[model samples]
Target: MNTAPHSLRPLGCLKAGLRQARQQRALLCRQMATTTSSTISSSSQTAPDHGFYKITDPKTQRLRSAFAVYSPSAIATSPSALAPLIQPSTSSNPSGALARLIVSPASPDPLPALHQVQIKRMDPTGARTALFAKTRHAARVGDVLMVTHRRGGEPFAGVCISIRRAGIDTAILLRNHMGKVGVEMWYKIYNKNVAGIEIVKRRAKRARRARLTYMRQAKHDMGSVSDIVFAWKKTRKVMTTRGGGGGGQRLVVVLRRRRRRGSRSREMREGVGERRGRGEGGVDGNRLCSCYLFC
Candidate 1:
């Protein structure tokens, strides 16, 4: 037997001790991190993982989830009340209905000052005699329209900032910005002074205000990409299991009272002779007794 002093232990023992110490230290650190993380997660409110704060209303003390402030019920019906908001207001009876027309040059070749093309009216009503014919689809505010001048020159293209559809003197307020300067021109559809008018782009389905003067003042047309990302985070759905099998169904089983194990074994032991009489085991009483003992 080779005996070594505790101080002069084998290299393997020293390695094992160091390994155990390291494992203990690692476990202690993991426990501390887990406790800290749990504390953070248990807080009442934390910033979302997507990195955006929830907007709260100061008055209502509720989250502001919508982009617009006005609700359906709060919409003002009076034109005077909505004038300050720069929203468009039309009369109860509109004048000659608005329509779109293809205002191209009369000639094929493009000129330096003026481009010549034939004009084609795209009104739903088949009326070529009148310039302002009643049509099912009328041009409204926020619609992009192209207006050709009387000299068959380049068309004046802009978005309809406003529309005044009051009787025979109906007119449209077209706004076109040149560099930093903004230019607005009002045109009567029935006037022979204007060559033609064509509807280029329709307004968005989600447009709130009829007069989109607010758009000119806005820095951006739509919300930021971060807003969209944060929106999805705000509207997460609850998780659920999906299947067409018995796995989703929960069943409750009721079990009847069972005989006591000891009582059952004793009964089997006493009935061993009766079982032998019935010729169950062929002349093996000891085997039958052992089986009854384990019953």
Candidate 2:
């Protein structure tokens, strides 16, 4: 009985220890849960509301919430008071609608406005119209074109093989032969680096296809066009000399001669000839005179 009591005492102590351990584990789990809940609540309270309007801070150069400038309470209390602050939309005032949409309580879609701005910036000069329009003189496939660079290099002359027209992203492919090797280049038409584009030679006959890729073969190739380009440039120079202010130099020489004659007549009227004369009628008898020839 004494041994039985001793063994029973050990089992009871083990049960008590297990119960205390379980209680400690439960207390630890409860503390962790409480801490996590507190952290989550604090984070929720401090989180920034991205739905609100944002204004740029001039001093910090950062975007901040506009709650201070436009409070919800003020908007709710006197909606009518802010009506005058909003620009009135009218048919005569195109920008009024944009202004109202920006300052309104709701967020406005920016896609339409951005698209208009992009379209306006794409082709401000209407050069694309003159180049790609469906007219008789517009640049087309198989036409020789010269592209000059704004930074100054030898102008590239080539046969236009293909044209890709995608609004601001329009481009053209040109092919030429250099040192018996074929060379090709792609040029963006509206790029700022491109100085000018001129049609050098039109095709003898209209190309049956849009892209002249078949010209890459030996049988269909047009070969080196350097001679044609040189002749065209020479002819252009001759035409410019004949028509563009070529007579202005001659007219200037004639004007200079007339001014000289007028100055001589003025000097004669001032009695300069009489002062130097050796005989009557303001004449030097021994000197040969050219006044009669001038008269």
lDDT of 2 at 126: 59
Per-residue alpha-carbon lDDT of candidate 1 for residues 91-154, written as tens digits (9 for 90 to 100)? 2111211110112123333332221111222222322213233332455566666666676666
CA lDDT, every model vs. true structure: 0.42, 0.60
lDDT of 2 at 116: 46
Per-model TM-score versus the true fold: 0.29, 0.47
- In candidate 2, position 192 carries an lDDT of 67
- The C-alpha RMSD in Å for every predicted model, in order, reads 44.4, 22.7
lDDT of each residue in 213-295, candidate 2, tens digit only:
99999998877778768877865553343233554565345445555787565554344323223223413432211111000
- Which 10-residue window of candidate 1 scores lowest in summed lDDT? 286-295
The C-alpha stretches of model 2 lying farther than 4 A from their native spots are 1-122, 243-295
After superposition, the stretches of candidate 1 with alpha carbons farther than 4 Å from their true spots are 1-136, 218-295
